[model samples]
Target: MKRIGQAMKRMTVLLLAAALTLDPLAAASRQEKALAETKAQLLSHIAVLASDDFEGREPGTDGESKTLRYIGKQFFDLGLVSGTNDPGHPWFAPVTVLGREPATSRATFSRKGKRVFVLQQDVLVYTSGKRALVENAPLVFVGTGKTIPSRADLAGRVALLLEAGIDGSDRQTALIQAGAAGVLTVLDGDHTLENVAGHRQRLGYALGGEELGGDLDAFIAGKALDAALAGTKLSVKALQDRAAAPDFAPLAVDLAVSLEATTRETKIHTHNFIAKLPGKRPAQGAVLLMAHWDHFGTCAQPPAEHLICNGAIDNASGVAVMIEVARRLAKSPQLDRDVYFVATTAEELGLLGAKAFAENPPIPLSRFVAAFNIDSVAIGPAGQAFSIVGQGLTPLDADIAAVAKQQKKKLLMDNRAEAFVRRQDGWELLQHDVPAVMVTSSWGDVTRVEAFLENDYHRPSDVVSPRLELGAAAEDVDFLTALVRWFADPRRVPYRSAAKPG
Candidate 1:
């Protein structure tokens, strides 16, 4: 009997050792398979979306139709619930886009009834709608124009402001609220008025009719500014230096500005693709994933090399990651809270889809745990750090750091946070008090983004090439998956707030 018991114990020990050795191997194999599958899907989706036939995947065009249908079908196939509130299993949220093209754009600035600025050279003007006209409005140099000064009242006056950091603050909103008639911002960066001339020609659109106010938002160069302040007590350079100081005063410059612009109006329709995976626990709140799928449409002026702006990196990469992540999560065990994936539209236009979604969400705003935006990603290799674009805007940095550590990668704040954080669709949700963050590879390695923008940011050359690698994008998918998993965990519900980092 003792010999029999010893033999059984030996057999049990051997079996336990075998299980331990094989379990890790099996897990490694499964992980590799999942990564391989996701990578393959990412490449395939980019190929299809970036094809020239899609006409650049522009909003409110044939490209939009094809793109939305493909995304909806993929989400449906992945078994995710429809993101819409409609009774049927519809995945689209129709958004109306009112596009206005500049017909006759003009901005003329004068000092004491003498013209000192040249249109498209010294100054450029843009309107919110079809036409904007402000004649002989007194221009008051309001420094940063961020807050209403105690002694200064800019009622019915044009506020001349030095360009401020783009930290998601709406300067125009503040200026308008301060009773300013219009705003004329001086170009402060390395860019000149000529550099921004091309932007005034792009199609401008708004989400709702009321959102497009009849305000003049114009850009002026240093040359015109110098001419305006030529004989004034405060020189342009001196005033700019003083404005940078902490104790700055609002100055009323000795100049008045005039603007007249007209745009041809066009009405179009766009769609936001949404899919949700309901969780077991409802109180944990839902996790939102966002990626803009729209790009520059069929170029009115097609380039010679490639007629279409195949935005392989601008967003096809992001949508592919979102789809792959959704597929994997759909098959995984039930999460503690719901996960929502939104493929926003008109992001190229002006974050119209995101604005619409924020304005009318499928669920209550308070139920959203956190919002994550994935834009133009992976232009580099894996193992590199990931940047949180709106790092200080929310407390999600802790969550991002934790995920990065688990992936054996690094976490850093976006170096150009002020410039990019509010530029993406995430900004719309952030404005509505949703804790949103944009994760990208461009945060730390500014060169990667600069290279992309210089070569193919919004041009026809943006087509997928050997230079555009997917290693970093693949890693980001894993990082985002981990974040969602954490957010969905009932025991790990995140604290939602809009506290800026000190």
Candidate 2:
């Protein structure tokens, strides 16, 4: 009996040694298998979402209905409950959107009670409402519109801004906040007035109840400004040169501008798909994952062989990544804080849905531990470095860096991707002091991203194909899974004040 016992112990020891030797290899195999499955899943989701039948997933269309059903079904199948917490529409949160297009617009300029004779074609006037009128508001040249002159009482006055690569939305918002009755952007860059007019002629959308008031937003041709200032000391060229000075201040142009714009408004109803994985400690802060699911529908007119902008890489890939990450997290052990998933609507239309959600959140915005946004995440190949779009703006960078290190992924520490921060859904949340970031390997390769943007982005050519590089996107899914786990752990990432990071 003693001899038999010794032989059995030796056999057990050998088995233990063999198991130890193969564990690393086994783990590696499992990881590779998971990655392959993630890639396949990503492709499957993108194929369905980017299919011609989805009609580019435009909001408030038959395409949007189909998209909502598909995304809701996916969340339901994953055993996630409604994050919106509305029992009547458990899986969806309603977002009312208003679409407006300029029908008729005209602007007139006067100097010393004499008509300046500015051509109507030289200026494009637009409003966020049905009608807007700005009568005889004096024009004050505010240089680049980056700063309002303290001495210049801009109340009820028009602020003329030199277009010097400044963001139009930010410049307009700044001037509006400073009590400017109207804003006019002069076209001084590569973009011609015709190009600007062509782009703005289309229907613009914003969330309901958030429309612009009687304030005027107009763009003027530089020549028109020069014509209005003709025989005066200030010319467009002189004003442009003066704007280059560091101490440039607002200068009163001897012109009074009167403008009237009429818009045709239409109301579109859309919904944001929301699902949640309940955590053990419900009172703890939650982690949110978001991706916009809307794209331009029927972008091309008839006679074009392809008429739809499938948005395969623009956002189908992003939604797929979000879905897969949710799936993986749902299957893992319960997290301490809830993980919420939102597929927002009308992101292509100025992030209307995201704005609505922020304005009226299911949970208090302060309860959100961290938020990560994914967009156009299928451009780069595998092994590309990852970038945080909101890199230096938030305090979540250290935790994100830790996860990247653990995953053996290279993280670009530069804030170059911050240029796109205001262009995505995260910007809306960030405006509300929510900690939001977009971590993607695709944006790390600026060349590939730029090529995609210039060539296929928002065009009919953005379709699903074998050439859609999804390797890095799959890796991002894995990275996000790890990130959510890290953030959802109450013990690791404790709840902090939700103030915007300085």
lDDT of every model, 2 decimals: 0.77, 0.88
lDDT string for model 2 (460-484, tens) is 9999887899889999998999999
**Cα lDDT of model 1 by residue, 46-85, tens digit:** 9988888788998878888899888888988878889787
Model 1 misplaced regions, further than 4 Å? 1-34, 104-126, 131-199, 216-261, 300-303, 406-409, 413-419, 440-444, 494-502
TM-scores for candidates 1 onward, in order: 0.74, 0.85
Worst lDDT 10-window in candidate 2: 493-502
Clashes in each model (backbone N, CA, C under 3 Å)? 0, 0
TM-score of 2: 0.85
Which residue pairs collide, candidate 1?
none
